[model samples]
Target: MRGEGSAASAAGGISGGDGGASGTVPPPRGGSRRGGSRRGGGPANRRGRRRVLRWVASVLSLLILGTGAAGYLYYRHLNGSIQTDALNLGETKLGGSKPNAFGQTPLNILIIGSDARNDAANQALGGATETFDGPPLADVQMLLHLSADRSNMSVVSMPRDTMLMMPKCTEANGTVHEASKGLVQTNESLSRGGPGCTVAAWTELTKIPIDHFMMIDFKGVVSMADAIGGVPVCVEQNVHSRTRDGKGSGLKLPAGTTNIQGEQALQWLRTRYGFEDGTDIGRTHAQHQYMNSMAREFRKNAKLTNPVKLNSLAQAAIEAMVVDPGLNKIDKLFDLSMELKKVPPGRITMTTMPWIYSTRPGLDGRVEPKAGEAEDLFRMVREDIALDGQGSGTPASAGSSPAPSASAPGTAGTAQSAPPAATAAAPAKIAVSVRNATGGKDGAQAKAKGRATEVATLLAGKGFTKAVADTQTGAEDTTVVRFATDRQAADAAALATALGLPASSVEKSGEVPGIVLYVGKDWRTGDAPPAPAPAPTKAPDSAHPLNGDNDKACMAIQPGFTW
Candidate 1:
């Protein structure tokens, strides 16, 4: 009865405005029992059966009650075991335009999984210090997009290795760091300003608004998965993981679709060396699959509807979660749950930003946007467009400027524009250059040059009177459209669209002194537009072939369960 009351309070506070207080419900009257007893055969016979049945029922009820009580107590123990206050989720304003969906405002949630282990709670949760001895980086940074229509949702993973201008951040202990102190690593940003600073950094870099953030450490993830029984995940190949240091290792799973819970789930998510590429990208894709499978499994499990399981999950989430204080209450959590419940798994899409190794001088290993690629990706999110289909824009060239348009203010050559950078008194011509960067195919160079000329011609028509395509060996795979400054970059992006180039093929080259254009394999110079993709073949009972109609159930491990 207490457990039931607790469930009612928690759910009611979320569903209604009860403030999560306990309440008492009156017991049933005695007349109903008497009437049922009278309907039985004879008074003595009824009494005997009722007595035996009551005894058996009472024992069974007690056993069930005892199990529930034990489970609840165990959850309380787990909650007490965690250090919930170690990470301070600093204040973050909801930035960017409101997202459109289901009459409910779109929400951007920054989901962070930290590698912090300096504290005792973290250490107990199997968090260990790396030999490198740097502060914990964001092991996982995913931005969840709940669309305005509530018809779709997506998770965009921002790679830790991305090279970006990190905004100044104040640490938990009131330490301040500058964004302009040279290019900084993405994960280090989290260590500096906590989640707020990370959100700030993303906002500054991409100019998209973020709504909320939720972070969970290793312990929380493991325990949550365990509580959920297990998360179903599909593995394309066999995986065996062994840590060289031996602190965290020993994961072996046969290649196929399987339900992974607890330690096994953690291993699957954390394994980096097992993949062929062994890059974070591969690991990211794996995590995406794991998340999808988990969503599926959670939906399928009937036990999840049970009060015991629901209580366990809620308690675990509350204990392990370090969410924005605004979301600390049960009502807020329930509201979020209800809103998110409307979104089906089929509408949930996932992707990583298009990136390549950072080309900034001397930063060989780090990754950066391959020109305008990241910007375009961010813009797509801002616009709430589906990244998977034709709805997605083309990738811009590395370093291409933002598109100049009536929509974008303070852009180059606009009605209220600033003039291009000054040359000598003669007003030197800013010649545009293009080279065949797509590695050797006969006539490719000439074709690229011709296309470049055509693009230059388009630019000239748009008041870039002196634009001209360069004839040179631009055989590198990278197609960069450089601009002199923010204004010029904007101008170049606008011209790119009119020139019929994919936005991805155009990029702002921070290295280039002036506006330039680069093209990649995905682009072609032509007057006529390409045909749209054919519709997917529909199933007999389905009108939309690509519609994700079938529900795929999955499970996630609860926080405390062992592998």
Candidate 2:
């Protein structure tokens, strides 16, 4: 939110696109109002009811998805409500996702919750009325990944207080916001341009292609909460998120399970001090609880069968969001909803980016991405490997890179078998960026000095004369060879193979210009990278993954805030 350089990291869901049943959109077939239909429980009616209810489940897919796809019936009016903008304002756009063996590709959308007090409704919802008409801040950022099979989904949230290098972004109106001098709070990236800039920062950080973006402000969360009915949640003790000088969310709830809706629902998600240790990280955990509970409650609610309620919720949501041009139309949105509907709640996994406070003196309060585990987590998503540790891939137990297995381009963890020999351009012709990512694990400094140049020289000696070393340094637990396009996959694989790295150590990244070979701590002094480590069998505890079907989840109140 950073409305006060802060954020509520509002509850998120897939945003919707159409209007209510009363509007222009047609009612779902086979089902009709009780008085309007002579045969109430006919086969078609049953089918229609199931179909209609499934659509509802998809829209409320989470905090944002459920609210986004429901309003197309009003057609023109609902369409007008959806504000469209440029998709990616970054200088270089990543290529499209490669399809699986079945010609299916995964879907990636960035959900942004902005803290904009431009209008009265927003000003009230986002308190601090004095700061009206201020620049919007993306307080909440979540990356939603729908697998190529459409059988599983993963959501990764970036805490608002995270510190990262903001990429250089250019606005549609010809305004240029130079990249930050150093790492800045992730929320501040929104002010660099618009949501596209935030999109740019994410792509740069995670090296994932962002197909679309949906942004909603404080009021949008409040409006959609009513349509979601009451979401059941449990607390360990009676807690109040309030302080002596009015510095908390003002939420007071008795211990145990309770149904929450409307502003109280919003408060439930926004209250940080009462939920945990009063940090943004703890608030992120609370948000996950709300989202998971919402998905479960939505699936069981009988009211979801009513097309009227679905449309109303959908309309209110699309009207409140700013989306990329790719999702501006109703049919496109409906199509997205259908894909989301295919993924059951049990297959959905939600995680917050594992992070630790910045060690830099002035920025110690700000958080930085946790090492190793975070990299492994992102690698799993890039490969369409479900974080819930199910299906296709090796067990998710230890590390990410599997032992050299196939010659294929990096994707679809199971379908990595490429041609017997994937062809690559001549060694001299390929442009490779060799970066030194040595050390930093367990409080170790970058001990391998000139490692990037040494590796670059090694590549040159091997006939890859175009290999160049980057001056910037980073921390990588193990060595990895990353490439941009699929065409470059063969070359990347060739490089990894040359370095004796495993097939799993080679990955596809959207932000790289070409192939990047990072000499990590694992290969600090050796000519060849280390052998592939064991793959992880489960998500680490630091990620705090919450599955949609887990109804037993309960938030523990902070000792200071609890009764």
Candidate 3:
């Protein structure tokens, strides 16, 4: 047995009995030397030695097993540290994503950062004693999307100042938050019912099924960053974020790559005052750089296999995390991390949603989603398309035949290849549903405001007196005419003809009612739709995609913030 060696060896080699160094150590090349010891000679002494060796083995095995039991108990302790609640607290439950052709579905998790100072550690990190015990705001929100093949990942960050209609949510304590009648600040949803409410708001807006959520506070960020060792960040110039009154992120860094963690990492992520343009948009970009650099350096260090480092991450996460029911267990969390590990750093892309300053009342300082571009970004995630542009995933173009587009409204579509121009019957007495689809693509012009009603009115000027305009949005790129039944085919063609659309645009559908006129993006302001180009697969240029492997990139510092 391994423990038959010196006492020092016995203590060191007590891991297992599976042929490991700790398991067995061969006797000095052969059987114990006879007469080598003064008390040794024949079978009696040999038998005694054998008994001692067996006893040592037994003792070593017992020690190893006991240590394993302790480790198991610690694992249980870790599990108990984690808290869980519902995945979605919205009364109107959202649906899940369908599996791909290979029976693989994507995993979407929302990572939330709360500006909460409920405890001593948090108050120290956030430094707002007057605001302690107040409703927390989600200062940071990122949706992490793992592709169906686990080959790529995409992150979408929503600025805290965004304004939207938050859905109805109920807390675990049975407090019901009614849906907003007017647009509300996106970050306020966190105070309604915890991170679950935030998750509900995101799912309702993006319509992307979220599988789980993880929420952390200021203190949590510091502890987790400490466990990650350090993440390297770069600045274009030496800069400090604080003003004379000490109102800022308090970040100060030299113009170069520096491996930062703990408090410094937190500052770097929150340093909007020192970054370019000195706005929340700039802070969002800085956060992207930190996240990407951490993702890259974490794998390069290969710390996941190190037991001490692994334990540090686990302990940090457990102490400062509140997750959904699906990830309440340690083993489940490990499996999820494994899935993320399968993706290489280069395939990960992080972007902020395209946004514009809001003009809505009382929201002058806040932002709203930029109409066309924001929807395009959401479309990519909903369709499980990789944002890194290395994959060929494409959204179902909104400008398809009579069928409705699977993408969000206002997304530009291209003309579908279809039949030759057909003869039109009289346009009299035909009912048409005119819908505005001039919404997507990062175009210089915003959506045509009254395009649907304008088209409906145009149909009225023509012989089709029963045309109606609705608020329903379409993502079609080319204008099209859809008819539900065989009898309405001629009527649909007549309406298409009146709008100067080609016959290829008339499509027969089983789902549409009567006849519908989809005023696609191409026919936004014109009497006739123009010839369109192919549908775009890349995100709008405004998204500012940062790849994980881009280490040379540096944050641009503002002139006034320099030290």
Please give each candidate's TM-score: 0.53, 0.73, 0.63
| Candidate 2 positional error at 28, Å | 49
Better of 1 and 3 by TM-score: 3
Better of 1 and 2 by lDDT: 2
lDDT of each: 0.46, 0.64, 0.62
**114-148 in candidate 1: lDDT tens per residue?**
65555555454441223124455554677776655
> Which candidate comes out best when scored by lDDT?
2
Model 3 scores a C-alpha lDDT of 0.62
TM-score of 2: 0.73
TM-score order of candidates, top first: 2, 3, 1
> Which stretches in model 3 have alpha-carbon errors above 4 Å?
1-76, 172-174, 304-309, 392-535
Structural RMSD, model 1: 20.8
RMSD of 3: 22.0
CA deviation > 4 Å runs, candidate 1:
1-96, 99-104, 127-134, 170-175, 243-248, 390-563
